[model samples]
Target chain A: MIYLRLFWEFFKTGLFAVGGGMATLPFLYDISDRTGWFTHSQLADMVAVSESTPGPIGVNMATYVGFLTGGQAGGMAAGVLGAAVATIGLVTPSIIVILMISAFLQRFRDNRYVNGAFYGLRPASTGMILAAGVLVVKAAFLPDGLSAFDWRLPVLAAVLLALTNLVKPTKKLHPIVFIFASAAVGILLELSQ
Target chain B: MKELLSLFSTFAKVGVMTFGGGYAMLPILQREVVENKGWATEEELADYFAIGQCTPGVIAVNTATFIGRKQSGIAGGIAATLGIVFPSLVIISLLAGVITQFSELTWVKNAFAGIRVCVCVLIFNAVWKLGQKSVVDRWTAGIFAIVAAGAILTKISPVAFVLFAAVCGIVLQTLLKKGGVGQ
Candidate 1:
């Protein structure tokens, strides 16, 4: 039953979570809230592990969830199915549309409305992407079980934002550098206390 | 072939180094695949990105498959896929041990916190820039707003959202076609 539930949940997550793996946060959170499949902390750990690992963070997480719920096979099942569902979910519709339109692509290829529609899609996708970031931020910093949301992280986030935009010099800085530098600074601060 | 091996290796390097997710992988992928190997042109890479966006897997994986298929045919596609997945497996395995062991380390914990926040910022920036290309008119802007609202209100599955976007594009295009504006 657990395995079936895992498969279904992941299948659903894969079916809908778009923009990328992080976009699945709300679904994962919902799953956690509804089922005791894993704790909120586990979800966070999954994010860390997923981010630190490879392939896709969301896929990595599905595998992690499967593994935690069942074991090796469970993990593999969840991972593969989650990936499959998500991939299929993401692709299936587009594939149908492309196939349907392939014959007429040339006819409407230069159509303004077609072009305009794509133009619209870009920002809409961007919005989804932005929403994904916010949801993840909420999950990452505050989490569900928190006694209180961490004020420092938000303040830190604002600092990072100002530093990125206003500082100008830091705007083009490699993300990894910011990642490591911030980490180092965070550690140093932790150690100082 | 050795060429296939090289393709595998380069994408593997990309797969290994990328920490966050799709957006994080973009710069490195562009640097290595587009800039370094010259295997794919910028336009081709952009096309791959669109296809990747429409595909059913990680954009990086879908991209590898597309590029590999383009470069070396079926075998090339397999090689590229292998290359991309390799780093992820190794990195995750190595990290599993290190993270498990160091899970409680203050420095490690803090560092993760720091990286997580940075990932958020990077995601925002990427979306912001990408939005510049996407929201070109009121109609598109309306699409953007509608999709954004749906995403926030429901946190709908990405698949549904993408599908919704695709339908919206198709319908708009069809209507425009009916109006004979393109002629």
Candidate 2:
């Protein structure tokens, strides 16, 4: 039953969580609210882990959620199976869609209706991504766990943001470098406090 | 068979090395599929990404499928898609046992706090670049503003937003066609 439920939920996620990985967040938030499979704080942690890890964040999240839910029912084997099922469920729609597109893309590529719809979708996706970015900014700065806003956090974010942009944009540093440096800063801040 | 195996291995490598999800994988994808393997041309890869973004599901999976199908057939697509996700399954499953407790630790929490901030910056960069590309004309700008506001301020389902945008585009394009206006 859990496997069936996991597959069903993630199939829907795969079908509709359009635009990319972050677009899936709203659905995952709703899942948390409705199913109680994971808490919002856990969702935040999932985001952090999914972003840090290799692979699509959406896939990582679905697998994590499945593993947790399955582990609650059984043990490690169930957890691993749940992870596999959930990942497959999440990618199923992509496989289907891609196959359909490839089949008809030659004939449909110049279709005006297709073009028009995508014309709209392009900006809409951009908006969704922007909203996603804003949400992350809000979470990063105004975390539910933190009762008080430390002004220094925002200053730190701004300094890092500027550094990412201004520090020789031509020969840009890898994002991993920034991630590690920021993590070190975070640990240092915690230590200082 | 050999080509399919290589396709699988190449994408598996990409899945392991690339972080930050689909957008971050773009360069690697271009490198492996377009430049290295000659499976797709640069323009073809760009087209794949465009369609991938608009279509349902993960961009990485969709792109892999596109290239895979181009290379062989349905089997190739399946191979590539599986390859892309194989690393995630193995990695996430391995991490699942300890991640919960590990995340709760103070230093881990601190580290996450920092990582989240960096993620925000990365998202901002993605949005800025996407906005420049997508929000070009007046209608698209309007669509962007409304969708952005709706997503942020309301509980409207994202699926609904996407459907509404598609409908709006059709209507707008139809009206423009009737009025003899160019998009």
Candidate 3:
């Protein structure tokens, strides 16, 4: 049942998550709320892991979530199977749709309605991703709504934001570098305390 | 048979090199599929990227399937699609197995906490860049505001929002055309 549900969830994600990898975040959050398979914090970990890893971030996330859920349900073997199921579920729609599009590439490309839909979709996708980013910030910095705000994480996030965006030397650096650096800082901070 | 293997291997290599996300894969994809393999021309790749953006699913996977199908057939598309995701499946499965086992450690927990904050910031940057590119005019800005507010306030499915926006785009464009207001 878990496997079936996993496939179904990712299938919907793949089928409707237009834009790119980040577009899938809202759906993953919704899945977390519905299934309780993972927490928002765990979803954050998945995002970090997915971002730093090779291959597409969305595919990495789907595999990561599926593996974790399956490992919890059964064992390591089930975990691998779950990863496959979820990843396949995620890509199944792309494969089908792309193939269909391939058959009529010229027609699809020239369609006025298609262009119009994308014009609307682009901004809407951006909006959804923006909403997802806000949700992530809340989950990371204010887990218990506004009442229980954590200053330390927000401060860390601010420094990181400055380093990545404001600092010229670091602005062009790969995200993996920032992620590893943050992890090291986290460990060091914890050790000192 | 040879072509299928080549499709798989080429995409597997692209998959391994693609860091961050779909957009980051563009240069690598251009180099491998266009410059090296000649599977697609530069303009064709751009077209694929544009189409991939609107279609459902990850843009990188969609591009791979597009190029692959153009080369051989549906089988080629399947091969490339599987190749692109194979690395992620293997790598994440291993990482997930290990992380789940050690997630109880205090140090591991702290590291994840920091990583999570960083991830949040990264997503914020992505949203900012995307907004700059997509929210060009008044109508788009309106759509962006409405969707963001709806997503934050309601528990409705994100899929509904996407579908609704698509319909709105078509209708709005058609109305504008009829009114002689060229976009």
Candidate 4:
């Protein structure tokens, strides 16, 4: 039953959450709210881990959620099965749709109508991604709505640091370096407090 | 048979190298599929990316499917898709076991908190980079604003917005084409 539910829920997410991995955040949040399979904080943790590790964020999240939910029922085997199911469910739509596109796109590849459609789609997907970014900020910084200790300062600093990598010597470093650096800073700050 | 194996291995390599998402994976994809393998030209890969973004799925997987199908066939598509997702499945399953068991620990908890904050920045950075590529003109800017606002304000499904935007693109571009705007 858990495996079935896992497949169904993630299938629904895959079917709808258009754009990319970040676009799936809203649906994942909804799943957390509805199923109680995970918490908002856990969702945040998933994003962190997914971003730090290799592979697509959406796929990583599906596997993580599946393992967490399924680990509760049986054991490691169940958890692995759950992950496979959820991950497959999440990508099933992608596989089907891309296959369809590949089949038909050859004839229409140069058609202006098709080009026009993509022109419209590009900005729209960008908007959706931006909306996803906003949601991530809200989930990470204000999970309980507004509070006394505003976390925006560190967020801004983090943005600057990430952006700084675009300019000079730091630009060549791998993103994992940034991820681990932040983790170290977090532990240091928490222990100091 | 051997070609299919190579397709699978190539995508598996791409999957393992991808961090963040599809955008971050572009350079490596170009290196593997374009420069090294000659499976696709640089231009064709860009086209695939554009098509991949509009479709309903992770762009990374979509692009892999595109390249795989181009190289072999539907079987190749499945092979590539499976290859791309396989790494994620293995890594996340392993991490989930460890994370679930130790998430309550003080140090792990704090590290997650910090990671969450950094995630906000990373996502925002994606938006900035994607917007630069996507929002080219006034019309696109308008589309970006309207779709963003509509998504936040309404209960409409994200699919509806994408469909609407597609329609808008067809209409607006057709009109612009007729009017000789970018011709």
| lDDT winner | 3
Task: Mark the 10 consecutive residues where model 4 chain A has the least summed lDDT.
Answer: A148-157
Off by over 4 Å in 1: A1-48, A51-55, A58-117, A144-147, A191-193, B1-7, B23-55, B67-76, B95-99, B174-183
lDDT of 1 at A7: 65
Each prediction's RMSD over C-alphas, in Å, is 6.8, 5.3, 7.0, 5.5
Error of 4 at A121 (Å): 0.8
Ranking by DockQ: 4, 2, 3, 1
Work out the iRMS of candidate 2.
4.2
Q: After superposition, how far is residue A123 of candidate 2 from its true place, in Å?
A: 1.3
- Candidate 3: TM-score? 0.64
The lDDT of each candidate is: 0.62, 0.77, 0.79, 0.76
In model 2, state the lDDT of residue B101: 69
Summarize candidate 2's per-residue lDDT along A1-193 as a digit string, tens digits: 8899889888989999887787788988888898898899888989878865778888889889988888788999999898888888998998999998898875686888866776777778778667766766776788764666777677777887788777676226655566678778888887213
Deviation (Å) of A183 in candidate 2: 2.5
Kept native contacts, as fractions per model, are: 0.37, 0.67, 0.73, 0.69
Candidate topping DockQ = 4
**Model 3: per-residue lDDT, tens digit, B55-91?**
8999889999999898999999999999899888888
What DockQ values do the models have? Answer: 0.30, 0.47, 0.43, 0.48
Off by over 4 Å in 3: A1-90, A101-106, A144-148, A191-193, B1-80, B92-99, B179-183
Report the Cα lDDT for candidate 4. 0.76
TM-score (chain A only) of candidate 4: 0.61
